[model samples]
Target chain A: MDYKINVEGQTARIKLGGRLTFSHHREYRDVLNQLMSHKAQIYEFDLSGVDFIDSAGLGMLLIAKQHAEASSAEVVLKKPAEEVQRMLKVAKFEKMFNIIQ
Target chain B: MGVLANDVQLEKNQGLDSIKVKGLHNNIFVNRESVEKSESDIKNSYILVVDDLEMNRKVLGKHLTKAGFDNIEFAENGEIALQKVAESNFDILLLDIMMPGIDGFEVCQRLRSQSCYKSLPILVQTALDGDDDRSQAFAAGATDVISKPINGPELIARLHIHLENKFLVNRLTQYHDRLADELEVVQQLQQDLVPNEEQIAAIQKNLSLRLSAHFQPSSEVGGDLWAAHELSDGRLSVFLCDLTGHGVVAAVNAFRLHVLIDTLEEYILDPGCFLTELNKRLVALLPVGTFATAFHAIIDPRTEKITYAAAATHTVQIMSAENMQINILEGDGVPLGILANETYETIQIPFPYGSSLLCYSDALVEVSDSQNRNISNQTVKEWFHEAKLKKVDVVEYILNALTSCGITWLADDLTIVSVSNETE
Candidate 1:
């Protein structure tokens, strides 16, 4: 998946698009770096553009949340696609992160 | 007949009777290639000097000894030269082309025919001006060609090149063999991590459940682990866990999970709790940024239901035996080890008689379809039903179904386990 991160004030909004799977670790690392670089109180993962997400893609989200939580930052999953939402719900990410409808 | 004052041959001519060198130039670095120990193996190199005449062997041996080549042997004919090499290991062969019986070319060809002497360095000593002999020696498998009336320094220098390259190649081959053997052990260990055929047969003996599983790892050692255990409560508990990446580290993590799962025997009937506790244990056990997507389910014959909780896994499906209608199970929960305080939802569905529950790793659904589209859960379901309708192997049908869909290679390990409450 391709992601564009925009940090304004204390909010870091990461817009992730396309498919996210095991092959995207290299690109996902950059987003993790962006999240750690710009410390923010609110980190939003814009997953609405992601059409499909496999287990590895979900694992990447968990990785992001772990990084975000370490800094006492709240990682919010924002605007997930229906399929992505179903994937997150199946994985039960609601317990870990607050999904923004 | 006047040699240089320093014992070096100053005059070069054929009339003075050049050393009639005869030996087999062959790649003899075989079988015991990498066994050479110590840095002086090259200098302490055992050399075989072959010639047809005693004068020739003595003359070359003198120059060889002067060049610090102490370990030397001689053969008066090519036949003896071939026999000596066949019996013992020589670092290099200084072969003389001119011989009475078994000429240098014939001896060299004979040695080359033997696989052991394939890489043995055979330096053919001949007339430097004879292009025909030089090419023929090379064709007969000579590692190199050195002229007769052998210059001591030139011979030593050429020997050093062949020996160094030969040893270096042996070391590389040794390292490669070691890695292959280690990987084989790990692959076997990975195979052992899952339940074996005997265990599956034991489960089948219960008569309440028909179980079949297939695990095909990609070219590498993958992190897919699955097992089936008969619960003390007359239930069957099975789980499939696929770690993030593959290879040694992922394999080690799988071993850790295997050990941890054994400790969770108390939660055999509770699929949700089993994963929750497993997740907590994994969080403490696994390093940060690593996790596994898994599915744990308990099959109860009394209730005829399957209670399962999935952590981002795919292919949690159940096929009805009556109509062969495949239903998808929503694998609910976050991946294990990602969150310390995570709750996996326990969703129970009816497992009517003649119904089968399938839980597989994501590798199945991630493949492309026949139309070049990625095979999703829906496509897999259709393929499963198609397999059942045709009365063929479901897993094989579905896996091979993607062959025309551009799934020429398995991108990841494919693992699937099915438990059917046939009761018949």
Candidate 2:
């Protein structure tokens, strides 16, 4: 998996591509570090390019959200693929993040 | 001069000059004795001398020969040295710095980069005595250094030390690899001991109960085990056990339990007796600081009742199909292998047609949430209640819920066994 980060004003947008599973742990941690370093008020993870995600990947997303919230920042998930959207809905992630179509 | 003339004639005519022949014989005998005396010291250790100057090579060769090292090869530059190293295994390398094309340091670094040569000793020999040069050689992976006009005693001492250490490391590596391969075979044997799909199906068919189970080990092998047997009185005896630890030790314990239960087929109908006997055996067999939590139950289709005993702290949930009511059977006694005289109590519950019983290891309730804290048992109970209302497979529903809640890998071994009386 790979990620590209863009920051504008107080918002940081991280675009993720490829499979988001346990194998991408290091890359995900690096993205999280980048997000924390920016201290952005709003963080958006664009998951349209994500083709697959396992339970570990979902757990990591939750960790990222928790970290952002602890820093008084808001996190939103945007443009998830169809399968990713179904899994998020099944896991009831809407209770945690502001998911956008 | 007659002897010299006679020696030439001897070579042509196969005739001998006695005095000259005796001298030749003495020389051959002396040479053989010397070679035999040094053979053990050398042991055919191949040493490479990398020097651009032929004179330096000859000097080192003579010193090594005097030290009983007969097997030596020469490489004029670092490039040639690397090529020679790749071609065959050399016990030690005597490298010279300041050579044309690919210096000694670069050769050492490149050799170190390859895993095969990672442990090969490269002794740097140089005339330059700068601190920077020494540090650079060390940084580039030179094992040891011999400074200018090499000291014969120091060179021999360093070579002996490095060669011994290298051989020791190689032997250790071989032992480690062999041990790993053996462990893999043990792991496979343990995994094969678990009930396969065909065995589960046969048990389900014989017992007239819908059975579903999920077993996931935290490692290659785990302590979690579940088994079902058809009792003599036509009841289904099912049990789930979880040992205190994971991996090989736990797997061995699981195997022992499996064999023990299979041997105690007569006690299956009485849950209390079965658990008592099992606990007694475990207390005697299990090592200190190790114990097991288990739930054993007998399902009698004719009597429409379930007799069960628990030696764990985890609650067993039963969902009644008649009214969709969930009943939690609280565990009452200490885990097995803890108190030898502790007797377990058997609880009887209505196992009417269409009722389902869920038995699981603590791994189910011990799953961590997003904040890394364990998800409460209350939350798990609520999910079970919801699953019961939905009329879903209780085991599948609980495992799926846990997975959806971000529990991909369990910290402990997980074993969930669900038995439902579907006969209407």
Candidate 3:
């Protein structure tokens, strides 16, 4: 798994690639730390490259959302692949984050 | 005439005395105090010297012998060197680079091509001092290089270092093999902790219940566990537990819970008390970061009631055979081992004849399809309703449906248990 971060003004765009599961906890934590340190007003996660996710992956996203909210920032999930979008819908993630096509 | 014979005999005596003196010098070289400590090491190690010239081979052999290395072999050329290596095991190889048929560099490269000789140390002895020759030797997999006029002490030190490393590698390989064997045994033992088919059948027969279950681990061992015990008072106690993670650590926790439940058989009638006591034991025994989610229930056939308590977030559903309706029971308590003083609550419901109660781990709801959409609880309830309408075993029906829908691999350990009252 890999991530590319692009920061412009107060918005940070993170593009995640590869499978998002329990095994990617360390990498996800590192990305989370980077997001917190940047203190971006808006955080956008680009899931276009992600192919698969599991229950633990949903839990990780929830944790990330909580962290963003605690820091007074808003998070949006953008451009998810078809499969990723379905997983998001199944987990009812739309109620938690601002999901844009 | 007598004086002449005496002088000839004196000359012969002097010749014998000179030979004895040379023998004494060789003995002194072999028995030196400085090399006494390494005598056993050198004797145990086998050294191979490959050189085309007979005189050079003799000189190298003599030096090695004097340094207390009694086991030495000679290879006149590269071809013979390869043959000897294949036939016997040598701790270190001393190869002379310049040979007629096959050069030392070619020999080293060929030996390194074989997996068994990948870590074998090949010391190159070259007469040429050019940088090109040294680099070429290294590129051909030479471990270290020595100049033509070999210094005895330097050779001995290099041999000792390489042999020590080889011995260490051998020891580590042995330890790895032993550990793998032990883990295999442990894996089998962990599988044995679950209730076998015969035990499940006997429980069903004795308690007048129709029980069916399915269990699969992502690896050799798993954290999911289920057991059904028939109480003496015509009651049945059933429980399923899923630890935080999977594999050996989770399997060990499952074994602990199995033993703990056996010890607490007296409290099996009260769901709330059993769960509370289980939480207390888990909080004391489990590590800080580990916890278990569980569902424990007691069914009384005479009263037709089920009392259950859960320490997880998964919903347990009871499908009514009367109206083909599904009633969901939500588990709202915290997972076990998380808090020291947390209490659990139990809910009682009527287990009417022909009604089935379904219990499953999170892996069931988390199962995804080809499009990565998870199987929602509503879909599962619908399947249960269909199974009830068809009068089939609900657990087997759901599993077969999932398999037919391309949901083969589960990301985590999965266990599903269903108990239905067969008495109508």
Candidate 4:
């Protein structure tokens, strides 16, 4: 997926596109590591353009949230696709993160 | 020398001086193409080409060489391809779906089922163009399918895809094997913590001891553990316990049990109190669905005394010297994980010198024949009676007896610890 990082109002947003699967683990971890340098008050993830999200992608997301929480930052999910929304609900992860559907 | 080669020489002369030189250059390029094509037709790789027609094999071999693949092999029918795959590793298989003696689909399935070539990639180059054909290829484990009367570029592309995938899968298997090896090393290290039977014998002064172990893992690692520890008061502590379930998690619990016992030896001296404390700590730390059934006994050979306790384990047997007297040692309490702050009372038995205590995991008593008939315990008792009360090699004797009863596969981890009194 295409990954873009933007900073707005003390929140670091990671914009994603296309499929997120096993191949994206390294890139996803790299993105999280880069965001940690700024000491942002809030970390936002954009899944609006994501066409698919598999088990490995979900694991990456969970690890990213854990790392962000360790640094005293709040993680929020923004503008997820319909499929992404369904997966989050089924896995009961909606209650753990900010899901903007 | 040949006519075609000489015609190219005249083309070099007839053109207007310099203009003819450029045209001759173009003709040379054309001539070079045929020569290069012939060179490619001879390159070598093990390829199994299956086609009903003989001419099809010749044409396909010619084209395959042009694509830089040589060492071509031929099989007219699907059965031959399967036989060849069973014998050797063929790099690429060019299969025709419509063949006699087991069609391409069946051949693919049989090849996959063979012990040797299960991972060999098969490409279906067939005239058949239907979802049914595609599904059949997939069901039979064919890596890819290409349409017949193949476009050269498309054939090359499909070949490349399947070969690359096969290479990746083989590399992955190698990595998995290396990981399994490392895990085995770790498991052995964990197993080494338990003392062998000889070490247990050295600690006991009066009682004759025999320790036998059976570990039949449902997975790579087992959860059961047995240890013989020399306590501070000079008594030997013999412990046999089965942690819940099997595999890595259970093995981890067994390690924890070892550490807990080591720590308990330093602080708690009483067998009853030590086990009770161990039960409380384990229940608090272990995840749900994890618990242990254990029998722990402290034997003092000099005094001909043994203090014993059991937690959800079978009644232990104290065998007399004559092989006629057998006393059962039973303890009333729930298994270790069921209760906290639970007090256990120790039973003191006057174990005479030269007599032996037979303590074991449930595997010994739980053994059954092929038809699920109980044989382990009854056979052990009978074997002891027939052996003439001789002190055979302790560990070997127990293992030999267990094996003779047709009890080779212990369902759970099996361990027996025997201590002989040498003080008298």
DockQ for each numbered candidate: 0.41, 0.01, 0.05, 0.03
Which stretch of 10 consecutive residues in model 2 chain B shows the poorest summed lDDT?
B5-14
Residues B102-174, model 4: lDDT tens digits = 8888888877887676767688878888999888888887877777887666665456445544544455578
Candidate 2, position B409, lDDT: 83
Q: Rank the candidates by lDDT, best first.
A: 1, 3, 2, 4
Candidate achieving the largest lDDT: 1
Q: Which residue runs does candidate 1 get wrong by more than 4 Å?
A: A1-101, B1-40, B52-69, B96-106, B124-126, B129-140, B144-154, B366-379, B391-393, B396-411
The whole-model C-alpha lDDT of candidate 4 against the native structure comes to 0.66
Clashes of each: 13, 0, 0, 21
Q: Write the per-residue lDDT of candidate 2 for residues B32-150, one digit (tens) a residue.
A: 32233333434567999999999999999998998788899999998899899999889889999889899999999999999988878888999979999998999999987778898
Put down candidate 3 lDDT per residue, B1-424, tens digits, no spaces.
1111211111113223221101100211212222333335546888899999999999889888887887889999999999999999988898999999999999999999999899888888899889999989999999877777887666665665455455545656776888778778877787677777888888887887888888876666777888888887668888988776677777788888888988887778888888899999998988644667788999877788899988754647897768868987767566676567878888898988778899888778767787777797777888888888888888899898888779988867888888887752
> Which candidate wins on TM-score?
1
Give the chain B TM-score achieved by candidate 3.
0.70
DockQ of candidate 1 relative to the true structure: 0.41
Which rank order by TM-score, best down to worst?
1, 2, 3, 4
lDDT of each: 0.78, 0.75, 0.77, 0.66
Candidate 3 stretches with Cα past 4 Å from truth are A1-101, B1-45, B55-71, B92-169, B216-219, B300-304, B323-328, B364-372, B375-411
